[model samples]
Target: MTSFFATRLAVFSTLLLGGLSTAWLQAGENPDPLGEKTGGSTTVYASGKNAFSFPLASLEDEERTRFVIGNSFFKRNWVEAPASTTARDGLGPHFIARACASCHSLDGRGAPPDWSRTLGPEPDATVALLLRLSVPGKPAAHEGVVPEPNYGDQLNNAAIAGVKPEGRVEITSQSIHGRFADGTPYTLQQPHYRIVDLGYGPMAPDVMISPRIAPQLAGVGLLEAITEADIEGNARAQAAAAGPVKGQVNHVWDAFAKAERVGRFGWKANVASLAHQTAGAFNGDMGITSSLFPQEGCTAVQIDCLAAPSGCPAKGKTDKAGKAPEIDDDTFGQVVFYQAALAPVARRQAKDPQVLRGQALFAQAQCIACHRPSYVTGEGPFPSLTSSKLSRQRIWPYTDLLLHDMGPALADGRPDFQANGQQWKTPPLWGVGLIESVNGHQRLLHDGRANGVLEAILWHGGEAKPAQQKVLKMSLAERQALIKFVESL
Candidate 1:
């Protein structure tokens, strides 16, 4: 028994050391993944001694306030409403689910598939909905290499039958053995989603597929407040700086502008703004009509889209020939307002010495490169998000709002406008500690594959592979400290 224990410990130490060394090397290069610098910035708030100030009180109010008192009034999911129609009306001809809170659940993160229920009829019922994409191969802009296609985007198993539900969406995850720098052998779960359902029928067998998990909604306003010049400047600085880390901005089609623009939303940074993104959710996720997406889903081509007894009425039509109430843009806007205003919960205030040490190590390892510590918002129309209030607030969202190549291992093989298959937006980490409490599950990443925060970090590759490798080399105590720090976020 003693000999066996010694062997295991030796192997573990090798894996850990290997992982940490790689991370440390990566950190020594350009440390600012988002390319942000702290030179001429003024203090946003007095109490908050950080770069971004937190408006705790106003944030709390935004989450609690309800729309006017009436049947048509809007309210957060937590508040009670008297009418069922209000809840039921927004359901889609091709909706994944009703209500923003349904997917986000308490405005928090979503979980991955429940393996316990895997063999059952519903394989991915309770998990967050994943968006898929497929396109022909193209030339790479940066590397000047030819792009290749893999599988397809998402598997939409649940569709309205009469509309010939688009293609079948399926996922198959495999476990791969990998050795950490410390020599610890760990099994990494790699997921591959296969798309069987095609609206137009058999797609090119070589079509590429990409999967994206819905992310949490907190602290988006802060991300929006970051100036475009700041983001572009940071990207340029990182390229010029001494770091293995590199990031770029994805310029995607702005439906609102009817032209391509810088992407600030979506896992791939494929959206330009929150309003456009919200409109997309209405059209893509629910097949609901909006000003941006005015067409009804092609039900004849997708049987599942027509499965519901009553087909969706034409955008401007009603059973009685009178003008129909305008699309609920205000209701939609209010929800976006609520989402943009939702305050991030306080970071975990752990008193443990080990956790405190891990916090410093996290900085040293350069995890903060992509997961930026804080940012101050510029002026906005909303009182809560205006420049004065923003100037007084300091927030820690832990993201750079830029795209990075995450390596082929995690690539979904689908292109979103300018973002290649391997690129993704830097997700904010604030309020992540309460994800499980609010949503009852802890699936991490854009598609909810990682089982926990540690797994999520472990799966990092491409630009972040160095960080992941460094994490593997830490002492067990240090690893614990790093995890504790993340938990506090």
Candidate 2:
């Protein structure tokens, strides 16, 4: 393990040997100014509530026009089938939300539903958090998990007028307490889930349940711009080190590419590209269909869901194959572009003394092992469709985009393709500190259990246990410095 003093000594040697002034180091001036530009030239300096909603500054007039159109579609609510608004009709017979923005408000992190309100409603539907259901068996083609016989892959708590909703999810929390080295107390909330008021007869006897919360959408294009070679290089280096921090790549079947590719999106790295992820969200979350997922989200027993009308008037676009997706390719592509071009917020107070001390502590704890600092992005998977603004840029997303065994406490106990129950992809930390400013909450982790940065740190185990232990041993000042540094990013 690299000691904090050793890292400081190494930095001093490099700066002094390179004939740089020692005063520059003492003043907390970042040697790399590019660090301030979190998403390269694409980065925008917005510290307010709308920080996560900005588009890339490099976008041309035409692209900016498309971005505005796409933003409209993203925030617009979908109506039930056979509505006058043909473009945005055909909402779910069963669904969790009406629009993409319902879950991902202002392109920021999703907070778990308010589980406290129990006065009038029999069961509560979550606006942001949703449960994924599967049974023990081999995965189907393209999709890596075996969908539940009746409920299918996802549980929809809200449905259209004639159809009964699948079920509602209720969450309860138990507090786990711990203390810092200086005897400062800390508390972490552990969330427990329960499904009640089933509309379907019953789920499979041995069904596996995994709860997923929508993540922030900024800087995804830059992550997509990273090459497969570079991602594999991270895995290879970790393996060669023979250290406790072994990161593995998740290779899943890509429906668009018609081949197995490195999974870049989704909580378990289950989805391949931004396009596929967008289409899947439309189909699964809102029961809206596109060319990629033309079929409705109905199992054999869902008679009303199967029979529901999919609205597409004569004015709407249709194909020669008689396949009419609720959303046309043109509108769908616009949403994809908007998502891919949303720039990450620039870092704040990066040179502050307290934040700098925390940064050293961050490295000392070896959180840097999995949360890799930076990468020079490459031409993306769909270079033809994506903007040039995404390519060949230095970015600091603070993730390796590889799955690691996060241990049992954080595990959902549901396996996804190359990711086992105990494993999860390292989520990007670029816009993390600004989640509260944008979304009015600070929920973190896969299930939105952690209330803040310190709570999230306490929840880490397995390969991250050592880092958690290091943090546990740090002084109160050191802990505050670490959190302050993280918040600045």
Candidate 3:
């Protein structure tokens, strides 16, 4: 018995030694999680003790509940029929997918074609379906070339083929490689797109293409709850704290209100409100009518739009209300409600010793400066988002919701609302870890080029270049710890 006990003790000692050695080795190879190496080492508290929890509170207002239902209506792959068509309700005349959920499954991130296996060899078709934009000249002044009328920025990949394709789009990718400040090398997958088979003949070869991947939808309701004034305040504070890292909100026209407003939706901070966003989607993505966007998208060059079997009916027809026909506003409103109410998932607790250490490193490295960890939302009609509950409430979304210049490496050379080329809204980090499980792909960033989250960070430039430089110098173990913390979010 004594001999056996001694043997067990020896084995335990060997395991402990091995563990330490492994950790030491890891410290040499991983990307820095805190985005840099701070000379002073500090201890991080374990997140298991102070993790954020997801709340499943009810939305009490009748109107708000109805909105939630509408937003979620397309959460599955079903599209509602047009108000006039009772027999066929879901398939669209021109659409990227049958429903919003098809692109943003489970309210999670989207993957690019290069990273998608289910899309098969016909990835170009999917690429054409992706959005594209151009400015027509140098400097891209705000009053420059407007989005192509009728066709807009996106090309409808799926169409009632015989009608008109909003125009065919093509996508191509280029691989780029770079090294961190510490001499660590990384590779990024970047995309280049072109519009082909234009009904109006060829477009200029120099027209800029910007591929967009649909982002996750969780906690958007909370984002919406953040007041415009508060967002502006945060931007001002960040600019003061760090000169080059400053951010700004985009203000644009609100089609719903027929007035200028602060922009919050879209990759380039274009659309101002959920109501306008829904209306735009109905018109551009699905070729459906909505109260805000009342016209059918017709290209002057497409002869078929003037021919028979065209989805639009004869010009002078009167509807039941004795007015021109359009998509029902109430149905569209419901969909917006659903999109604005998705709750954030619970965060992983930071109880583990390694995670605690990593969190401390994260703060010290200045990552929290832009990825602001908490915000208090204003009161709203939705019970779950009311000011009483939102005011001073601690929520960890990890985004400032402002635009920043990301440099030429990530630039698409397209202007959106007031954002110039290379500008993008800081995406929220909540539910990022489950993107693969929910969306079945691991693509990251605006174009879905990054093979992994690490790749995405590595691709950062411009305002985030300093943070990227810091990350390159971290020990492998420290980098792993940082990734672990992000996963916990």
- Which window of ten consecutive residues has the lowest lDDT sum in model 2? 117-126
State the TM-score for model 3.
0.77
By lDDT: ranked, best first: 2, 3, 1
Instruction: Identify the leading candidate in terms of lDDT.
Output: 2
> Where does candidate 2 stray beyond 4 Å?
1-34, 115-126, 313-321, 382-387
The alpha-carbon deviation from the true structure for residue 133 of candidate 1, after best TM-score superposition, in angstroms, is 1.9
Show model 1 residue runs off by greater than 4 Å. 1-56, 59-90, 115-125, 137-155, 160-162, 197-200, 256-260, 303-326, 381-392
TM match of model 1 to true structure: 0.74
For model 2, the local distance difference test gives: 0.81
Report the C-alpha displacement of residue 30, candidate 2, in angstroms: 12
lDDT of each: 0.55, 0.81, 0.58
lDDT of 3 by residue, 1-489 (tens): 444533433443222221233443465633222212110011111222111111224445664556456655555443333335532243345566656655665556666765322221112322213676554554334222355544555556555545555555555667787776556677776666656555555555555667778787766666666677767876787777744688888887788878777777777777767777777776665555555765555555555543413233224444565543234555565676666655565555435555555555565456665676655456542443445433433355677778889899888878866788889888877666667666566677887887666787788789888777677888887787677766656
Best candidate, TM-score-wise?
2
Hey, what RMSD does candidate 3 come out at?
Answer: 11.0
**Which pairs clash in model 2?**
none
